[model samples]
Target chain A: MSTIPHDAPAVIDARGLNKVFRDFWGRPKVRAVQDLTLEVRSGEVFGLLGPNGSGKSTTIKMLLGLLYPTSGELRVLGGSPRDAATRERLGYMPEESYLYKYLTAQETLEFYASLGGLRSRRRRQRVDEMIELVGLASARHRRVGEFSKGMARRVGFAQALIHDPDVLLLDEPTSGLDPIGCRQVKDLILDLARRGKTILVCSHYLADMQDVCDRVAILLDGRVCAQGPVRELVRQPDTWRITLEGVDDALRDRLVAYLQEQCGRPVAVEPAGRSLESLFVDVVTRQRAASPPP
Target chain B: MNLPRLVAIVRLTLRDAVRSRVVVSLLAALLLVLVGLPLLVQSDGTPAGRLRIILEYALAAAIGLLSAATLWAGCATVAAELQDRRLFIVLAKPVHRWEIWLGKWLGIVVMDAAALAVTGLVVAALVAVIRPAGGADSQFEALLSARDTFHPDWAAAGLVRAVPAAAGDTRQFEPKSVALLPGHSLDFTFPVSATAPGGPMELRARLGSARPNRAPFASLWEFGPPGKPVSVVTSTNAPGLSMALAVPAAAWSPGGVHVRLTNPVGRDPATLVLGTGVGGVELLVPRDGFAVNLTRGLLVVFARLAFLAALGVTAGCLLSLPVAVFVSIFVLVLIASAGYVQTVAVTGMYYIPLESEAPELGWLDRVVLGVFRIMNVATAPLIRLEPVALLADGRRVAWAIVAEAGLLLGLAYSAVASLFGLWFFTRREVGRAGTE
Candidate 1:
């Protein structure tokens, strides 16, 4: 369901990016990133995959202008990422919530909305919309410091989208969420992609990423080890899976035997099962419907 | 430039300070000190002395407490957030670095203003509730009233040995000394411009002798021209003690009036060696009331607090929380010892020279002064008027002094610190992890 055209313009462009961390004495200590070249086009959900300390965060920081590349050329939204004008159209959610503990959810959203240059009336509307979007309307008046990790994450997500930015760089978008929350976040990413927003997500949750990402890059030790369309990268070319409902064991056996005889090869058949995330979402949906909030 | 954005940041900062209970604790401490300080201290048994003790010590305590808190909060604001990774979200917004700096500074200043107002009101209320006894009013009137103080025109009287300080010197750090022998008259002329024969004035004289004058003597003080003189015999002659004698309104002549103090109006003739230095012999004309004077004094304190706010924010921008706090406290110490810094700049004596010791190198003075001058960008000419002392001593905190302090400390010096902060923070990489 990728809406990206072949001739889509690049929203985030990086070429031969390198980052070398230095010690107190200005000596090169660790090469966090080496020779990275990445392009995230408009209207795509691009996922970055890596183990801990594999330069994923460093690359994202560079793209957000939080850290300078030791050597590279980077363009975000067709301009230098450090520019305020360039930042105006970009939204970012850090790995941690990183919100003011003293502020309530409503105040936090309103603060970001104002910073994004929303007028007073529109800011109120957006704050209300974002609170509802994140399912935190009941908890809007409570201080963020009192929120659980998942609730704080929800607030963080709400703030990032408050400005209605076209490009989003989300670090670990579903780090501490429950299964239903994870599914909702994945669906939200797909919905945003459908609306022509470019998103760059970094996470270790491959299953969550696989459900939404169109293209993915797997990084190891600061370098790209593998990259391509998710379908092509994860596709098993030598095997196939077929599923049919209402097939008894004898009928299934007969079909398998006929396939093996015709192909002159041994074939195996197994039952298809639903993903845990899907089942969990279904259960939560039924429970919520049974006893909805008044 | 973005008013709404800055306002948002300011509101958040203020809310943070209040919720964290830091500002509340500070306010409580200030209130206790202002109300409790007078009750604890022992005054000179006189009502005026008691009032002076309360005003001086309580106000000083308030200023000291507020200043330390302002610096501590300033240092902690940005540095703590950065360490906690809270700044990542804020910085990711479309904010220029200068706006953030300005917003935080404004927040601290607003907090200080509110704190000062509370402390001032408490002190004023204390004074009102414990009104002084009836007889002491005239004694402390000249001290508490905001008046234009005038000293004897020593240059015109040919008693001055060196060049006099220029006109409008707000704080006359040095004093003018004059001598008067027994059986001789000392004419002290004060040329003050007032609409001829102006508002009632007083002659406040605190003259010292080579030896303490234990015995009382009769001295004839004649005001105005000899043709129509208003002769008054003042007999209280404790030389070191100050005495305020009311001058008749008619005593002020067209241009100026000369007061001739002839010692020994009787046969006793106790020599009044007039050592006019510091709180010396002077004329006082009431210009404004006590409330207006206190307001002016508070304005100076506000300017100083604003400067400290900028300095603290700038320090926070460049360092970690603990390090920033240390650096800010060090700067605060330096500012607190500004008088010492000034002494080093003027006399170039880092240490008092030992008896018969050789003078240091000639270049030493230049170097010391140069260093202080360089530091002037960070700590401008603050505390020049010593508003607390002025308030306690009953001297006027002139509008000229207020304007000077405001422009230099609040506006000009703060702008420099803020500019440096903005430049460094803009170029700094806030997301830099530890090396490697």
Candidate 2:
């Protein structure tokens, strides 16, 4: 992984990719992906945004080589996604945990590590690191069957990263996680991107995409409806929001009147506040700090 | 190709089998078959009968139970995981699809090996403990030791081409065709160059009389060389008879041991017909111990399980759980009923035509016969492995037969099944995330 140049070619590249699922008679039933041209650059965090049944999971499966496109080109790590070497450098977390119920958390990670071609010592080390990173150390020895949905998700996340893959295609990474786990995952994604790891995340959570994505492609019905940097895609030049600090009631009223006269319309003013996610995290952090687990 | 990945999948599969209590269930079933079967079967008071009960009924029941358990486990290990969506995690790794197939096979084989070893030891111990206390000693010995059957080489002895000149019969003295006249006698010899258990040798014979009544007749046997023959008298009326003769060791010549059957002038001219081929005459020579022979039989059974495991896994790889189980059971039944298939294959017919003396075939019979023919081509070698019968009858389960089973069932059949399985599994679209 380290041998690759920092300015390497795009890790994920697809052009006019189409996937048409067929019925028993081979007649096209659903065009799950159509004319989907997208590029995810090296060291960048990319997001696939769409609503339910909007080809998000389908596109992710294609990128992971779980499905083949009906037509056009698709590549990951400058080679076909179906290539074993390309898959070796990739990590995938599916929508569900899909873990072996009989294996403990540590065993699951170790199993994945072995599949990643790690030797005995390195596999053990990686398993330990992954369990610790996922905050599953305390429950590492417990079978995954006994874990809650959130814990299973955590284990899933750990397994995906146990190989320290250079690229990750995570579908609904935070679906079953609590706010804390979600925050930790988002932070971990950012940290991984900072270390030059290319990540492609598929999620319906707008805030999560906004927080970590350097670039995003929003799809609808198997086509990319929008693509660009997060700011560029969401920005509206005609509208603006300004937050003022330490402004009194009189100053605020005068400023709003001046803006209304200058714009030739009535101006609206509201206090800028922290997002609900941030507030919840703050409350949870403080409470946990007040009475930490022994 | 990837050793670690293969090992991991196999380990995980074994863990699943253990955690799901499949291993426990199989052990319990094997225990029930081994312990409960003796009580289920009423053994005759004779030691030979009791030993036959153990070797035939108990061992067969154990094999049947274990075979079912093996097939069920093989099917469930793969099919259940696929249905439960647990395979996605492993498939998502950098492992080949064939590795998964091979791994599941290895796990099932290991489980079967352990189960067979434990159950076989238990049955063997039970057989030893319940052995009758010193009665019908020869029959008991026959059941415990493997004996090689030797028949007279008639062609080598130049008897098949000979014509009895005294009666002026030009026909050859072939078995079942030859009729010894009242004044004439027939001579037969078998080479006993090999060591026989230093005791009286047993001769199994089937003699038919030309008389319409098939009345009881007295026959005289002269054992040893022509110069010095030991005489014995025995009455024969049935098609099959067993006669034990004690002759001095010195009586056996370097050429072979010779025995002559003569009929003194009876009430009417009596005729004797010898059985054709080896069936007419045989010498049973004890070869090995019962324990070793039992182990060889178990090895053959294990080879059969290997083939069954491959079959179940292949079915599971391609079909749903219920369908796979049904198909596997169907295959098991077909294999167990191989004797019927063999009959059909050889006779080239299925239903015997009652209207005619010979078997006649209809169109449907032809189709069924064709199917049986193809099945026999694929399964004849496996079908010939009658381990339970061999063990009960104290016949040697030769290493050559074991090797043949390993080659045909263990290697060839398993390889074919694995190829099909890997192909289906690799092409299978695992896109459905939900469990079936």
Candidate 3:
């Protein structure tokens, strides 16, 4: 029931969203967001891509009601973003791990759970589950200030999901994360999307976005330059890539020559190796697996 | 609006105060001040004086330290969180902004109450342990008990008119302020409401001489109604010396009592002037126990600190950490100096010594005084509610005063500050860091 048809009504709908930073005299300073019209279907993984100061964070802030747009219409969960009731179903994780440093991981999640109106027993249960889910079980009792950047980000992520919200707005979710943390976060996003949670992620990690995001909108200087399904946008009709197994150097050379003869151009040949992130993750995982934490 | 969210914020605030070592440091500082202060300040060497020193000076210093710590904690709780970006998480939650302000204020108040209770207990225990042996129980009771002051009903006695002292000295004095000539007596009648407990009362008088010479003068004080003097005292006093007389309950009537002070014909022909204002002519009657008096004093002090906590939080909500602290401290200094402001407002002059050279119109002084007048109107109640002077002098801190303080300073002032803070904090742009 969480997933809707391709033409289903939009859970997040914004049209002509514009946010302009102003000076003391009300003169327009920086147009942080401009003519932003976007939509994400129910239970979809949407990515917002931009370089620094390209309105990605600004857009996320607007959706979360942290910042008001200069001129636009933004609705989250079928109501204005400023509505407190609407926020009950929305969760936001900011760019930085904005958590109380003095609170332990469990306490941090518990606090957010309470804010989300979770009852006492359920709050405690969810806090425990979140700690486990974030892989912070060992450091659950440690103060967040003492955690490393990746661990803090995990706690931040846990707090955002503590309420079991319908929609998640994450800004630079994997900025401080290591490769393993980033991989875990990506998997978690995919899992949440599978469980029918609408997730809008803003990040510069193009590969991670490509891996988990169903659709993406690339922003350049406060404007959307391209937006479509990840597969649809990245596909090329003129290029073809083929992978083969058990082929020697002579066979590989023959295949490339045949392709070039057919296409009337030189065919580029390169071995497909594992990504560095995958290699690092594999090495760390195998080492940790060989010597499991006690 | 969300009670659970409010509780969560309060709990987190208290936890931060504890984990940051602010509470521990505050307690340590208070203990050092309370226990070590008696050693530093010189007492009168008598047991009564030593006890007074502990109760008056040490307790005052402890309360001051507690107040400062409360303000610091209040500022750090809100402003530091905003600067550190922790508040962004809270704001992003479904909690209302007012809940956050109230929670932080409650946390500071609860912590303040704990500190105050502990300090009170320690002081009381110290008093119990170090009490001087063999001191008269009556003396101790008189020193420690809260006593109400009864002033003579000058208007009821038709003595409201001011009598001229001498020719060309246009300064008129109250009829009760008369200087008695030899063999001439001045009678003062005071109405006693039935509420006043009938018992032994203490009468203190400051005798002033018309002559500059200091010499012993004989005078007689008669108590009770006409021709039915229950108590009569004939005493000699050096010029300008203060004296105390004890009158038994038999001298008092349910309706009223008349006391006649007569300068009996003596070797010194100089007249004597009874003091002026409440201090000039009054009766002391004991009321509440020392414990209740101390509690009332602490309550008023707590109310003041609660107001400060709200103010600190309000400032912190708008300003960064250092700037918030500075503004809070500045406001504290202004409130504390209300006495000077009051003087300026009343006299329309900042310096009393420059009165002769002061401009007749004094436009600049008038402007400053006008501003201070408004400030004094706002701040006088808080300054006057300080119980230190009353407690030191063994006078009762009236419950009415305590109630007024709670209503005006605790509830009203804090509510206004909290509203302002919530308004500013909610509308503020938290996405930008380190903003004013």
Candidate 4:
């Protein structure tokens, strides 16, 4: 979990959380969240990983009080989600990047800042800071309606951080972003975590989760299937590999036989090296390094 | 709880609306309908007449159009923002749900009011410019024309002559003598001479009516002024006809001769004065007329607009945009048609067959009719109270506006609640990354 000390109070705590939705015909349609038990400690980047329709969005919605759970004990900043006072300590960036299309990037930030009860002077400062922080300063005057999806997502991130809340819940923060934009968002999440903000990030990009998250909870069919530190979850045991060049056929056969005798199972030999895809990625990375920055 | 914050939210909402092209387009359309239509249809006539017609049409159109626009704008205020999830960002903050609701509601109300005022002023200005310049002069000319045809002509003249015939003759006069006598005239004396000789012969006298076929005739003396009275003789041969050989002294006058028709029958006869000095003649006939005073029409239009504004606001609160507009317009149409329907029904022009007596309408229709009684009600008082009604009417319009404000505030509260809920709900750990 990124070496976070366990003694800190969990920024988010929930027990026995459940949410049920009914269809238009008044029949129970789906259980979007079920018996979810989780804790997000302070100063950690937590990722929620799931496939489509896996209750990732639903759990996020319930956390934000956009939808009520069927039954649960949940707390953010040690208070009810529906409570206004509790909301002051939280910020959320929805999965869809919902924003007023008529407002410019700056206006959007200012509006959210106002809602956060920030005073005018401080709101202006915070707006500028956020715009620059999200790398939207150059396009701050452009209406959100004219912005690209990635740019709009950046504005969404800016609004979520306008109030500088204690916790940030971002749903699919980098869903539609290009590589550079995704990296920027990942870097922002890391920066926010480093500044002692607790963040719950929901994304489908497992590589992104592996790169940035201190821990992750994988959801399937409205329930978390597994959750822990990414490295620990994917850790392997008793697996060894050796690479050698110019080995004779007799030496290869002897090595294989020796290993097979040493272990109770069949010892197999294959190419011992980095994956081709990884090598290719490294080659592209080096090629890009050869070029000047745009 | 935070009034300033709420105000800020409201300000932002109004700003957003002002910047929205949809609202701008709708407002522009409303303004065009209010101002342009009246000017286009305005008749080239006296200011009062033009005003009367334009005010009537413009007021109706403005009230309908503006109310609809405003109500529609109101319906979209919350539902659209929520649908787009833009509300989610705002609600995620520390704002209250009620504040959001109130802010959105206020934004819509302000927009509607702006539209209403612009349209109302346009109609009012049209009315002001069209009001008749002089009220009494117009009324006097109308009355004079109404009284002209009823006055009768009082000057007319006719001559009378008498002829004498011989006694024992069956004919009152020979055909040759009848030709020498004057045409029909009022007979003041009876003729006694007929054959150039005085004799006490009874005269068979006939009075001709105005026409020749069936005329009333009177025997008269041939001597003296055409219309002067003379003695009449009963004999047919007398040169100067005399009645009892005496003539009344007062019958003759210097200026003109007097003529009178004495009815032999005892029944009273009707007479029309035919002399220049005729007096005390009166003519009466039934007449039909219609008039529209522009000032009164203006007052009525204003009253209707006020009523409609209230109704539109109320409808906005109760239903979504499309439904609210439909229902409100239907109500307006029904109300406008009530008078025409009632008039046709009262006059037996309605042809519905009745199997049984129709049930009387209850209090709801009564109240609607009472409030919108366009024809018979005292419209001035209502017009005078337009300002007060807008502010104080307890009906849905006023209450809807109030409730809308409340709803906006409620939205703000819900927004904040939603944010908190999202944060709380998402923070939980389902279990490991894939195997709960």
Each prediction's whole-model lDDT (CA):
0.83, 0.81, 0.83, 0.59
Clashing pairs for model 2 are: none
lDDT of candidate 3 over B217-336, digit per residue (tens) = 787899888678899998788866778787666777776667888888866576888875767777777777778888898888889889989998888888889999998887778877
In the range B131-242, model 4's lDDT, one tens digit per residue, is 4455433422222111111112212222222343656545432121112123333433222112211111111222223223322233333323454336433222122222
Could you tell me how far off, in angstroms, the CA of residue A250 lies in candidate 1 after the best superposition? 1.9
Task: Note the DockQ of each predicted structure.
Answer: 0.83, 0.66, 0.76, 0.28
**Candidate number with greatest TM-score:** 3
Better of 1 and 2 by lDDT: 1
Kindly indicate the candidate among 1 and 3 with the higher DockQ.
Answer: 1
Write one digit per residue (lDDT tens) for candidate 2, span A28-119: 88888999999888888898999888898888878777777899999888887766788889999988999988889988888889898999
For model 2 chain B, give the 10-residue run with minimal summed lDDT. B239-248
Which stretches in model 3 have alpha-carbon errors above 4 Å?
A: A1-6, A23-28, B134-140, B161-176, B195-200, B214-216, B223-242, B247-251, B256-258, B353-358, B433-436
lDDT of 3 by residue, A1-294 (tens): 133468966989999999988876989888989999999888999999989889998888888787888898898888977777888898888888988888888888988999999999999999989999989999999999999999999999998999999999998889899999998999899899888899999999898899988889999989999998888899997787888899999999889889889999998888888899999999999999999978
Tell me which residue pairs clash in candidate 1. Answer: B143-B394
Ranking by TM-score: 3, 1, 2, 4
| Stretch of 10 with least lDDT, candidate 4 chain B | B143-152
The DockQ-based CAPRI class assigned to model 4 is acceptable
Instruction: Give the residue spans of candidate 4 off by over 4 A.
Output: A240-294, B39-44, B124-436
lDDT, candidate 2, at B56: 88
A best-first ranking of the candidates according to their DockQ comes to 1, 3, 2, 4
Worst 10-residue stretch by lDDT in candidate 1 chain B?
Answer: B168-177
